[model samples]
Target: MSRRSSFVLAALAGALMLSACANTVRGVGRDVGNTVDATGSAVRDVAH
Candidate 1:
């Protein structure tokens, strides 16, 4: 039971770390592209 709990925790931590890294990379990429596109300013203004 203890080992199983440890494994679960480890797996969860690994997934969280991987997702964080992926999100960071994606966010950076999006930011660069968004800058080029003006970050959808027209859409945001309409929504607001």
Candidate 2:
């Protein structure tokens, strides 16, 4: 393959990996937020 073609392929692979990482981070953030909310609710329930 040509050098240009190789570079393009590398760039595309990097972009895909970066996008996947972003999605994973977003999912983790949501999971953490949900856990925090659940914990708060449990605390309030116990207090009441």
Candidate 3:
């Protein structure tokens, strides 16, 4: 393959990897938020 083609392939691969990482981070954030919300609810219930 040509040098240009290799470079393009490498760039595309990098982009795909970055996108996956972003999705994973967002999912982690959501899980954390849910955990906090659940914890707060439990505390309130116990107080009442």
Candidate 4:
């Protein structure tokens, strides 16, 4: 393969990997937020 083609492929792969990492991080943040909300709700219920 040509050097240009290899560079392009590498760049594309890097972009894909970065995007996947971003999505996974976003998902983890949401999961953490949900857990916090649930915990707060449980505490409120128990206090009531």
Please give the TM-score that candidate 4 achieves against the real structure. 0.98
Which window of 10 residues has the lowest lDDT sum in candidate 3?
Answer: 1-10
Q: Least accurate stretch of 10 residues (summed lDDT) in model 1? A: 36-45
Q: For candidate 3, lDDT tens digit of each residue in 1-48?
A: 999999999999999999999999999999999999999999999999
Q: Model 3 segments beyond 4 Å from truth? A: none
Clashing pairs in 1: none
**Window of ten residues with lowest summed lDDT in model 2:** 1-10
Q: Where in model 2 is the C-alpha error above 4 Å?
A: none
Candidate 4 lDDT trough over 10 residues, lowest sum: 1-10
Model 3 score (lDDT): 1.00
Better of 1 and 2 by TM-score: 2
lDDT (Cα, tens digit) per residue for candidate 2, span 1-48: 999999999999999999999999999999999999999999999999
lDDT of 4 by residue, 1-48 (tens): 999999999999999999999999999999999999999999999999
* Cα lDDT listed for each candidate: 0.92, 1.00, 1.00, 1.00
Q: Each model's TM-score?
A: 0.60, 0.97, 0.95, 0.98
What would the per-residue lDDT of candidate 1 be over residues 1-48, giving only the tens digit for each residue? 699999999999999999999999999999899886775887787899
Indicate whether candidate 1 or candidate 4 has the larger lDDT. Answer: 4
- RMSD values for the candidates in order, in angstroms, are 7.3, 0.4, 0.5, 0.3
